[model samples]
Each structure stands twice: as C-alpha cells, then as structure tokens.
Target: MKSTVADEMCTEDLGNVLPSVYKSVRLSVASPPLLHVNASLLLLTDEALSEVFGAVVEDSEEYQTLKVLRKGGITSILFSRPHHANVLDMKMVEELTTALHSARLDPTTRLTVTAATGRVYCGGHKPGLDAASGLQLRDGLHSLVKCVLEFPKPLAALVMGPCVGVLAGLLPLYDVVLAAKGACFQTTVVESGETPCGCCTYTYPRLMGHARAAHMLLLGHELECGEAQRSGLVTEVLPTTAFHHTALSTLHPLTATPPPALSHTKQLMRQPLLNPLTSVHGSAIMTNTTQVISMARYFAAGVKRNSDNAP
Candidate 1:
C-alpha cells in the first residue's frame, strides 16, 4: 500500500517512495556545529536554502558550517547528539524556520517533520561565560524560540532519553512529543549548582506550577516517564521497541493532511502561545545571556587552575 501522493512524486521503481523518505537518524559530518535539522523531510528550493544559509551563517560559526553542508545538498539529518545547548541555538532555529517558511511559500514543496534523537537528546550545560554577553546571548535565544514557535507544520519531538533543562523546558511548545518508556525528564539545574535557565523560569512554572516547579528547581530530581506524563509534560509514552512505529503512526496523518490545512490549523493552535513564547524568550535572553557569560568566566578560571595544578 503506497501513499497516493508519495507514489506519484517518487519513482515507482525505487521501492515505493522509500528512497524519498529520508530518516534523519544520523548527523552529517559536514554540518558539524548543529546536530540535526530534522531533515528527514527536507525539501527546499535551491534559492531559498541559499538565502537562509547565508543569513544564519553570518550570526554564528556553527551556522556557517551548517550552511555549507545544506548548500552542498546534504539532505536528511539524523541526530548524532552533538554537544551544543541542551536545546536549540539561534542558528539552528533560524535554519529550521527558513526551511519551514520556504516550504510554506512554495506551492510545490511539502514538509513533514519529526524530531528524533538517541537515548539522550541533550545532557549538556550551557556556558556560564555567555552571561557577560547577555544582550547578544538573549538575541540568540530570542531568535531560536521564535523560529520554533513559528514553524508552520506539524512538528514532533521523539524523546529517547533524559530530557533536561532547556530541552525539557521547550517540550510543551511542540505539536507532539513522544517519549520512550522509562525515559526520564530532568531539570537538574538546582542540583547541579546552577541557576534556573531563562526559559526554565517561565516554562517550568507553567508546566508544573510554583510548588512542583520549586521542588524540581530546589531538589533537581529526574522525573520518570509516568511522572512526566502526569505532570502534563510527556504527551505519550511508548515502549522503546514500539517508539518508531508509534511515532510514525502518529505522524502519518499529519503528513497526509493538505499542506494548507495543516499550516492553517497549526498556526491557529499556536496563536495563543505566540505572545507568551515571545515574551518569555525576551526575558530569557536577558537573564540567560548574563548567566552564560558569568558561567564562562568560572569555566575559564577552573581550566586555569587545572592547568596550574598539572604543572
């Protein structure tokens, strides 16, 4: 049973549009900075891709590399779980937005997005050094969230491991989120000797409320899948083995909907959150930037001490 549209657009001899169905399960080495752009359904006009690559590249070194790979026709990004922010960065967000915007504008282009990752999506800490460059960092975060919020299609995130910090903070914003059974969602800032992340301050409170949020922030415990769902964070929990099929099953209808209808519906649903995401990001940029810069200095001092001790 072939999808009617897939059958028409993809070559029949290629074994039922399977070839056109790229699953971004690995990262392309060429795009070193960003892990994966969720490129399983990457479809963009050459011109549009170029413009996006150019804009985002100018803002960050990471984006520069990503731009080159995308321009070189590197399609379909599989997640390699690269070390960056626990969540998205300015450049990655911009590129994602550019891809979606182009798809929305192009009548011929259709977009289907499913975000997947390894056992651990992100288990990294943001640099405290960025705190000194608060304004700049804030701008970066602002741009990142704006893109995620504004993307015009069904966006799904597949959580396979401990989703923590910013990644956990942003999960509620996605259209659909599927977590592997036993996978945990953690907000370890308090336990790890760090202040709450910018986004964490806003999103955490909303999702778990002041009391539970305070508990997580103060104690910094990892929430199991059942707890996460009870807290209204994880939407669905599937056994590790069933995650793939279940996610696809969930996304199949989203992919099948008329592009226009999908876009319209998504936009409507997201409309309410738009103002809040923007506002939260604004405060996040300011606070997170300052925190990042300060953290960087502490990191540098620790490095220096370690070097001196070695001598």
Candidate 2:
C-alpha cells in the first residue's frame, strides 16, 4: 500500500504510527531509506533486499554507502546501497575503513559483522581505473583490506548472495564467513591477467591450496556455498530460508566466550598473515600505479601528436 506523508509527518507521525505495522523496523533518516512499503521494495522483490531492520536490529548510523548498526555486543556494518549492487566505489571503501576503525576503537564492541543490502553482496570495485581515480581506489582499498586483516575483534561476513570481483577474493580473509545455500563466491576481474590483486594472492593460497587458488584467481570459478565451506573460506553453509536466523544464532555464541580468549585467539590466528599481506598489498599498488601512469603518458603523447597534425 502507498502512504505518502509530508516532511514533518515522516519523523514524528511515522514513528508514532509505525510501531504496530512495522514493529520490526524503524527508519529515522531525513530521507527515509525505505519503509518496507517503499518504492524500491516493489522493484526488488526477487533480489536480496534489506528490510527496514528495526525488528531484527537497532541503533544505526547512516553514511554515504553504509549503515553501522548495533544490537547488544554486535556491530553490523551493512553495505546500504542495494540499488547500485553495493559496488565498492571510493565512497564505500572509505566508509568501510571508517566503520572498521570505529569498531576497532570501541571497547564495548565485542564482534563485528559485514553484510550488504543487495542480492549481489558486492559487485566488486567500480569499473574504470584511471591514474587519478585509481590511486584513490588503490589507497582506499589498501586501508580497507588492512583494516579487515588487522581488526582485533571477531570479523564475520553473512553472505546472503553472490560476492564477485575483488570482494570475492577478500572473503577468505574474514575470520568467520557464513554463506547462504544459494550464495556463490569467486572473483571475475583479475582473470589470469596481471591484475595486482595483493590480498587474495596471499589469502586464497594459504587457505586453500596453490593450485585451487590459481584456478580461482585466474579462471573465475564460482564456489557454491558447500564448495566454499569445504574450501574453508566459509565457516558454515546456511539454508537460505533460515539463513538470517541461523547466522545470527551461530554468532551469538561468540559473545558468550571469554573476551580475552577470543581476543588472543584472533590475534594468534591473524599474526602470520599480517606481514605477508602487507608486502603483497604494497607490491600490487606499486604495479598498478606504474601501469596506470605509463598508460596515461602514452595516451597523452598520442593526443598531442594528433593535435599537432590537425588541419
């Protein structure tokens, strides 16, 4: 049903009236992201959609590409731009870095979970990588990946759908990854090319074998939930119907574990991967910068030559 409310009505009137019908969701943004009855819901019924989350979660801070939500000890970093397939643009990379940073600093935050709003969990990085934009993307991704690897608290991913592109590579790095039965995981862009994908190069090989990692990195083989779980990239394969409920239930146990034991175990587990990932990450950035800058110069020279010979 369509209910159009005036400006004053959205904040005040909606809040008072929402309790009964939308008891599970509450939205407080100036431009309400959605109302469950919102227009986008009509368009995205087939896709993985973010419900108005009030019933399932609570207390959120909205940013350009994310919603940092809190429910008790868990801080859920949600990719909020489902319409755009939740691609990792510069804005998203930066917000992810910021959210991770905040989580790292918050003493009360016992665990962190990453989930996206769309059917395509992440469509990967935004396309078109010029020198100017590419460097920002590189650095932003640098910070974001490092933040994920270095994150002291538990880092989890609830994959309700496909995770493709660079993001597909990063999944192996998360502490506990849970994928819905329908989910697929794999990278597409770096396909055997000299794509300086630093993180995945180190991560996938270590988790799975080098041969399998090579296949994943070069061939873009999609791993179904069971395959991913067997590969050890995912901790569990959850049934789609009960995924949200089961995924949340599985994580609640982590909170009950002693904080120090969790902390030390996380630290010990990540320690070995840190330095290698950093070295690989830095090398990829250097390679990409060199390629992008050289290509820029070559194109510039050709443009100048064309102008000089102009009629």
Candidate 3:
C-alpha cells in the first residue's frame, strides 16, 4: 500500500508551514479550569500573520484570516510584537481554528472568538504569499465559510488592520463586533490598489444594495471609523490603547451567555447566508483542497529541479 502525501508528513513537518496540516493548540489561560467559558485570542507566526495583514493593507488578500478564526470558535485578537508584523496567514488560521474546535469539543470548555493583529505580523517577503496565487489564503477562507455556515455555535470578529477587506462584510454575520480606533474599513478592489476578486465584490450588493456596493467597489474609497459605523460596518471603536479593555467588555457579556443560547442564535443568524451560499462555498473548498495538493506537488518539484540544476 502506498502512503498518501498527508500520511507521509509528520505533525512536526506540518507545523510552521503554508497550508499546515498539523494545527498547533496552545492553552493561553493561566488559571485553573472553570465552568464558564473564557476568551481565546488566536494568532499566527510573525511572517505568516503579517502576510494576511499586508495583503489587505498593502495588497488586499481578502482579509479572510479573521474570517477563519471566527469560524472556529475563537475571537482572533491578532497582535504581533512591535517591529514584528502581525499578518494572519492561512496555515496559522488552520492550526489555530483546529485547536479551537478541538478545545470546544471538551465538555468543560467554552470560548469567545475575536480577530485582530499585532502592530507587525507578516508573511515572509515573497510572491508566494500573493493573494491571487495564495493557495493557503483560499484554503483558509474555504475552511471558515464551510465551518461558519454550519457551525453549531456563535462567532464574532474584531477588525483592526490596514485592510479590513473581506472581514468588514463578514462582520455583519456576527452577533457582535468591535472595530479598533483608527481602524478604517474599505471594500475597494481598486484604491487599495489590489485586484479585487469575486468574494470582494459580493458582500456589498448582498448586504447593502447595487448602487452602494458599486460605489465602494469602484471608488476604492475607505470608510473611516465614523463612516463604517454609519454604514453598519463597525459596531464600535475604541482608542488603540483601549483595545484590551474593550475586548474584555465585549467578551465578558459573551461569556455570560449560556452556551446553548449562543449556539442556537448563531445557527439562526447563519441560515440566510448559509442556505444560498453553502453549495458555492463547498465547491470552492473542494477546488481549494485540490489546488493545495497540486501546489504542494509543484513546490516539491521546484525543489528537486533546483537541486538538479545547481552546480
């Protein structure tokens, strides 16, 4: 019997890599376990995390990293050590979400999910991280959409990054949201100077209307915090210094909600989005999985070709 590529990779090899098959689960709480749910902030490696941030801020990778974390039951408050970039890349999302889902299944545990980033989280400097070419980006988004559509629990996001990209649109799906001070929102595929794809264009028309959505997609203008609030994009904004305090406030209320209520509310809210979107999302994911395997193959081939070509 032949071993599958997935079977060939060990958990160690799977970590810290693009489209990581092995998800790393870290227990962040310091105190002894409690009956009530606690908050979990998910993040990625500096380079990987930075990639997601930069793509949205610099290039617009669809800001799907935040989408992924929220799906898996964690409110991703992305923070990177200053000077280190905080870009939530695909591998990080996968591992973090997998960890969250795993933790959620434990009868004793409960979690509140939010997404944010540190001052400097980035993927490495390489075209491989490009959103259009990003196997991991698409894969990660696919995972989140699938999970979110059918998830038996509530999820939310905190958008605070250069490129709020797809996250702003997705935030409306959540029961609650908090946008950081100075955190601007935009769905522009042009002014952001990044090529906007199908996903970027869909949200506005679906949520608002054709004319409004077109203004956003075509003008490439950003919605400042106030504008975002007016547009119903952001629920609230806090001074950068107050992000933690605001998070505590947002999460505390969430923690107090009974698990069953949270789960039920999440399901009901998701029905409209999930009903029409599931088949499309499912097809995309299947395609994404295929692309990942193919990308991995090409990656391996390039290495071999390089070795053979080298003197």
192 in model 1: Cα distance from truth in Å?
5.1
Per-residue CA lDDT of candidate 3, range 81-154, in tens?
A: 21222334555556545644643564433454555443212222111333345655665655654544454655
List TM-score per model, in order: 0.61, 0.76, 0.56
How many steric overlaps are in each model, in order? 19, 3, 29
What lDDT does each candidate get?
0.50, 0.65, 0.45
Model 1 poorest 10 in a row by lDDT: 16-25
How does candidate 2 score on lDDT? 0.65
| Model 2 weakest lDDT span, ten residues long | 21-30
lDDT (tens digit, per residue) of candidate 1 on 1-311: 43433222222121221111111112121122122223222212223333323212222343321322122211112233222212344444445445545444545434433332333454432322344543454455465456666766655666754555555666766777787665666554543334554356666678878888777666665677788788877788876554545665665565456777977888888788677777766765565555566667777789899999995
TM-score: which is higher, 2 or 3?
Answer: 2
Between candidates 2 and 3, name the one with more favorable lDDT. 2
Question: Tens digits of per-residue lDDT for model 2 on 255-306?
Answer: 7888789989988987887788888888877776676576666667888899
Give the RMSD in angstroms, all C-alphas superposed, for model 2. 10.2
- Model 2 regions lying over 4 Å from their true place: 1-62, 191-198, 294-311
lDDT at position 29, candidate 1: 18
